[model samples]
Target: MPEPLGDDLVLLFAALASTTQAEITAALADAGYGDLRPSDGYLVQHLQHGPVSIGDLAGKLGITAQGVSKTVIEMERKGYVSRTPAPEDQRTRLVDLTEKGWAAIYATRRARAHVNRELRAALGSGASAFLDQVRHLAENSGALAALSERRLRP
Candidate 1:
């Protein structure tokens, strides 16, 4: 029979996945938005700062331009973002956040902060510090940083 996964590995993976999902769901709820997932927020954040092309947003999210275009269309329909003709290139359109998008992003940030605070409190000072150290170590790895940067640009 195959060996079971190690305790540390299981805990780490479960914690990472659950925390990400919980944080995302909480943020969306706090923003008074529904039907928007973390992937939506990821795209919204990039467009929130300013206008960007579909290709650029795709590159930032490490997805294909076609995929980004589809998501952008959905978001546009939801009134979170708008696509307008780029001044420099008539063929390409740039995506920009609407007021609703800005509000959502702001609320997400605030909700995430609250979640982090609650986590810290639950973990206690020492455990929280240790957990942060672990997170930093995991995040600071060269390959991980590269992957994250590729996925999250803005």
Candidate 2:
């Protein structure tokens, strides 16, 4: 059997990712984004690329249309997203990230970088190899493919 340290890599990865997320969330709150829910970050990240129809967002998120609409509505009210009538279908509306939403995305990226800095500081010269190995393992195990298909769930 492997050593105890290698026995629960999944749990270790999860705990570390959760802690990093908490740090990012706290930074967002301090940046005046306390109104965002835990799951809202997933939606915000998904919308970063461009506008998408409600149905498309639902499909990408694996949720119902109404659920996506409710999320979009709340985010719209908070200035994170705006909906407009789609050019092709006036009956369908497209949700686009607002300037505020983009700012949140940038802020989150900076927060993650800060977390990485901490990792580097803690792990020193081993940090790069450590991260590369983690990714290598995830890819080999097919976790990356699954995650890319559905995205992360906060």
TM-score, predicted candidate 2 vs. hidden true structure: 0.88
The residue-by-residue lDDT of candidate 2 on 44-144, one tens digit each, is: 76776788999998888888999999999999999999999999989999999999988888887888899889988999989889889988998999888
Which lDDT value does model 1 have at 135? Answer: 75
Cα-based lDDT for every prediction: 0.78, 0.85
Off by over 4 Å in 1: 1-6, 143-154
Per-model TM values vs. the true structure: 0.80, 0.88
Prediction RMSDs, each to the true structure: 3.2, 2.4
Worst 10 residues of 2 by lDDT: 145-154
Candidate 2's C-alpha runs over 4 A off are 1-6, 146-150
lDDT of 1: 0.78
Best by lDDT: 2
